[model samples]
Target: MNTINTHFRLSYQIQDEAFKLSQAGNCNLYVAISSRAMRLAVADVERNKFVALEDYELITVFTPLQIAEQLRLIADQSPILQEQRWLDVRISVSNQFFTLVPETLFDPTHQEDYLRLHSNLDPQQHVILYNRTFGLDAVNIFAIDGVIYRMAQSVFPERTVQFTHQTSSLIKSVLHQTDRNAGRVMHLFVERNYVTVLVVDENGLQFCNVFHYLSPEDFIYFVIFVMQEQKMNPEQETITAWGDITPDSSLFNMLKKYIRQVKFGKRPADVGYSYKFDDLFDHRYFELFSLHFCE
Candidate 1:
């Protein structure tokens, strides 16, 4: 990982020798946004492979206007993001303003009502939206910061940018990666200040939620709590993890200290990645890369 100190620290960047700036029109751009970080990946559609990536870390928590400013700054300076000719652009907004409602109980006219039950929405500040979870029989009702949403739309003015919640991508990716015939398993995606826990069984998506924590102890408490609530035994049930974690990191160590079958996750098997990505941990960009599977 290479770090370039700037408005937002460039934590990691890698581009394949085959990637070409002029051919961006044939590529798909995937961007993941959060309070603590922003990341983008470029995939060459004709080749069906990811060709480049840029991961940026925010120094501090940012509000709507501040996040919009950061997005503007990054778009102005980023080599790949500045291009407006992408074949498609999909963005995953990572925030606590999303809730899942069973498809049978969902009503399109009541999107705001569904989200209001879980998040405090300001009509002027956030734009409420929804994404259908294929095969899961649920819809993810979410609110994206209006400033940030407009900035993202401005970033790619020519095409209709597809916006989705980060958990939506995680659900699509995890369900694709897990063995449907196998027993239930818990998947955790650890970000800077929060952890998203997803439990999948042979039937389909069982449980999915995010927990904020300030320390390693706080992190494990949520993990164990989810396990107990799902009737999963930490001693025997498998817990696979991905994102912002390393084998020697405090989070991983703590997970092992508690859960006996802790394991690191891998990249989505369906999408091909450039050899340039070999230097990265397989689990690091799971959500960003999984955007390929997002509708």
Candidate 2:
């Protein structure tokens, strides 16, 4: 019963159990029944199909005897898998024993040599680089067209020229990996203790912010300051706060009022204006701005 096109290794005994599980309809649940044993079964109810074993692009099932027979089969029968075996390909950090080639054919020392050879050939499409100190953590958020996409965490102690240069290089790598080169308006939220950064474009939004402070006002102020410093037009940008705080939380209530005050009336004389505590906490009084304003 071979339906999925992913490839990986499993013992003959486990493969027998997977075949039974696949037939039992348990494969549709997307649950792993056992971790100690290497087994995978995927059953798509919509398609009424099942695959007892999978890797990334190879899937097949054979009886315990057949599996053993295939282990001795020449590598030509599994062309793509054979190439992956020669290259010492690994799907992920886990599943170390899972290899494209049979265990008998594996050379432990050669694996490292092959990996080094291919490492430079297949550089990551995107790279993110940033530096941080031991005590403080920074969160980076990226959004495109009002939708959130990715978040990253970094630690920063002091601002050094080398650190700044490294961060710039990392940003370039990320952009290259994502294949996005268009101008993107980015925002940085820096509080006394931590910093949050946002990157936004037309596609959607991605948020990365740390939870160092409990107050939402601190987060909002940081966002506003970043926008102003970057010279982004307030009218053209959208800011969505993300973290442990929810939209209906008290902090969000204050933010709604703050946004209104900033956008609607004359700029206040006080750099950081204070609103009545009662008014700030009134959830009914705060209406979420519509998409026309945010989008």
Top candidate, metric lDDT: 1
TM-score of each: 0.96, 0.25
Residue by residue across 1-295, what tens digits does model 1's lDDT show? 5243245778889999879989998999999999988999999989899999999887754577777778888887898888988989999998889999999999999999988988888998999989997558899999999999999999888889999999999999899889988788899999988999999999999998889899999999999999999999998988899999999999999999999988899998877999999988899999899899886
After superposing candidate 2 on the true structure, give the runs of residues whose Cα lies further than 4 Å from its correct spot: 1-195, 200-214, 260-295
Error of 2 at 244 (Å): 1.7
> Per-residue CA lDDT of candidate 2, range 1-295, in tens?
7432323343321122323332332223111111121222233233433333322211253332232233223122422222211111111011111112223444544543333432332223222222221111322111111000010001101111121111222222222223234445553322223333545454423332332344667756766666676565556654443222345656556556544422111111111212221223221101110000110
- lDDT agreement with native, every candidate: 0.90, 0.28
For model 1, the superposed segments whose C-alpha errors exceed 4 Å read: 1-6
Model 1 clash pairs?
none
| Cα displacement (Å) at residue 14, model 1 | 0.8
Q: Number of clashing residue pairs in every model?
A: 0, 30
